[model samples]
Target: MDKKDLRIVFMGTPDFAVASLRVLVENNYNVVGVITMPDKPSGRGHKIQHSAVKQYALEQNLPILQPEKLKNENFIEELKTLRADLQIVVAFRMLPEVIWDMPRLGTFNLHASLLPQYRGAAPINWAIINGEKETGATTFFLTHEIDTGKIIAQERIPIGESDNVGKIHDELMNMGAKLVQKTVDLLLEDKVDAIPQEQFFNNEADLKSAPKIFKETCRIDWNKPVEQIYNHIRGLSPYPVAWTELYTIGEEPIAAKIYSANKIQTEGQLPVGSISTDNKTYLQIACMGGAIEVKEIQLPGKKAMKIDELLRGYKFQEGSYFK
Candidate 1:
């Protein structure tokens, strides 16, 4: 069937997922229905927050399915009734064989990173934290394995020196939307081949995976090199920022949220976890090899501000050490 005529069942949840979903809607593709995560409590008031995909689907008045279990007999039966010509899975959860295999055209997914590399939940965060010079997005058929489907198309984007996860996410989101359109067009025209990743051969470079992140994973490690530490802070920045607590005289322990930092010279006289500052224009903390200048930071119960702004209120003695 022609792609425009193909009945597409779109699946995904977050803003990332919405990009592709929007592309299909704007292009007038036959997006017969949508599958997204159910609304869950969010924010201080605990009011329900709907998924971005769900919101978009409602605006377009598309059919939506938010089943808690894809494996349920009734859910699977309902999915089969759509008779989707092709299934497109974006930033969504895994599908059971009963559902993913139900579509005649087979299901495909848009992953945040180059497949076989960064193949798990937090691909964008992991790529930035690892200081990768290049990363890209991929759309591939969905097989039994997670993010291991056959390759359909790929788009490479540069990761800059000052790049963080948040910046990369925006860039990729736009790129993903465009790529999705191209993929669908080619898919309908039968101009693209869906080949297993293993067909082209494989190596160590192809085995990277993305694992879930947690609070423990966001802690700053002073023992690591300054570059890695700095990347970690920025990679998780403006989100679950890499944080540490500090103790000062005549005050309660304060949390430091590092959004930006740079390497600086330190005599290493102070041990790791030590802090020394000029008390005016600079704040530097010791790392494994050198010190990282706190270019941007936020303390507990305060807004994120530059070093100079924070220094104004958080005065430290010339020799006072941080724990």
Candidate 2:
């Protein structure tokens, strides 16, 4: 079958999914329709906001569907009318069997992590939080199980010691775009040999899960080793950032989000959560083994700024600490 002859229905909602859809459209693939989340009220104004995929699909002049209820008979009928031969999912919600099973060639998803590991909603965040030295993107056939279907292609990416979630996300977004195209190409030529994720593991205990991260999960624990704490900060940097409570003797505790930090690597340490700053360019917090040098931070009601800039406007008095 010609690559351009395969009618594809692409399902995605976020910017991550837009990359793959863009690649398919740019390559002149036959993407018959796009399905994204319904627009929702956002921000203080509560204005309706279209999903990233929806916005991009509009620019590309692709047909779009934003079904609030996937099981609605009307939605099912509309989807069937598209007459898609194949379906592609990326960063989208789970599909009922009725929808996934409708396509003749079946549905495939592009996941952020290697299969059998990080097989959940937030793979990129957990991989960085766990301090893994490497991770990758995978394209797989979707079945009854989520992220556990047969794999078609994968591309590995190295995680730098200082790399944050944002950096890794961008890298994988581009890599996933190419891999999605490759998966489609292989399917067109009938060259794909799907591999089950079970073949990679002998026991379930060996797998590392990528569960959803909540706000509590992003709180910084001062008792952990300096390296772990450093990893925690970077892993969540620039979004749902790692945070700590700054307590002053006479004032309410302030929530401070830490964005950029590094381990000081000292042999001796003060009490955990101890704060030492020159009132100029640096803020160091003591931990179990050493301390972390906080370079960028944001206090409540303030934008994220460098330690020096924050120092000029705000002061951490003597004996103040982060709890």
Candidate 3:
């Protein structure tokens, strides 16, 4: 137990990961090294891309390792040279047994969800998609199973009706930074007290799992309740948004992406999944119990725009219905 001074190896690769890393650096933690994913080409040109963590690490002048394979002996040897007391993993990929077991104080992770629940790659998106009112960040020891580890500390945050994945993502990123900083303080002072997850779940059953998101999963189900539908859209908003086909509010069938909308009531002659418009002020979609006013949308082959902007080039007939 190295009280007052602890050598840590920080492992992560995304903007989310950088949040924790930044806190560690700012708080004067003894971060011996950083391990992140290898650079890969992405986007239109598919040119090589340095990860957000890599860019931050470079700016901080922290030593970094971007091994293609975690099991590579050369990489493993290099990692051993860091002689870290603890290793903290954020939003990076899974780790190998050899690597995680090397640190003296053991490897820990900063997960997006409360854990034992939503224990997968896309916690923030799934939590919103599932309509959870409260979700949070957690710190725990790393085990063979992803996101299943001994509990260290967790901080809960409220999920408002208006909160989308984009909003929650930013919230968690900031929360994770503070959590990591506090976790490091605990590590340095030898005050960390880990509790086994099994104890907490001993009496509680029916634990939920957060799974990865796919393109097909992004499809909106108009048949479901409008509240559920609204949550689904917000959960994946601004990225892999829930989409459906609608023709100019009620015209020809065209694919449209709905980013933000609110549920509202409808009157007589209103059909489920129908569109109603003033053609001047509003474009609303009828639902099972109510109608939702479209705030932001994107039609096929066009950039996302507000209702006012979408109305400029595209026209929606009054009393027309959407499928």
Which regions of candidate 2 deviate over 4 angstroms?
none
Q: Candidate 3: which pairs clash?
A: 275-322
For 32-51, candidate 2 gives per-residue lDDT tens digits of: 99999999999999999999
lDDT of 1: 0.85
Candidate 1 per-residue C-alpha lDDT over 1-323 given as tens digits, one digit per residue, 9 for 90 to 100: 66567999999999988989998999899999999998999999999999999999999999999998878788787888888988998888988777888787788888889876898999988998998898999989888888878899999999998888889999999999888888888888888788787775557565766799898898888888878888898789777788877766666777778888877655563577777777789888887778878889887788999999988997865444444
**Cα-based TM-score, every candidate:** 0.92, 0.99, 0.92
Where is model 1 poorest over a 10-residue stretch in terms of lDDT?
314-323
Clashing pairs in 2: none
Query: For model 1, how big is the CA root-mean-square deviation?
Result: 2.2
Best by TM-score: 2
Q: What TM value does model 1 have?
A: 0.92
Which is the winner by lDDT between candidate 2 and candidate 3? 2
- Comparing 2 with 3 on TM-score, the higher-scoring candidate is 2
Q: Show the lowest summed lDDT stretch of 10 residues, model 3.
A: 264-273
- Please write out the lDDT profile of model 3 over residues 1-323, one tens digit for every residue: 44326888999988988989988888777788999999999999999999999999999999999999999999999999999889999988889889989988899999999877788889999999889999999999998877778998889999998999999999999998899888877876778998878766754456677788898888877667777888888998988898887744434677888998887754543667777776666788877667778889998889998988888788865555555
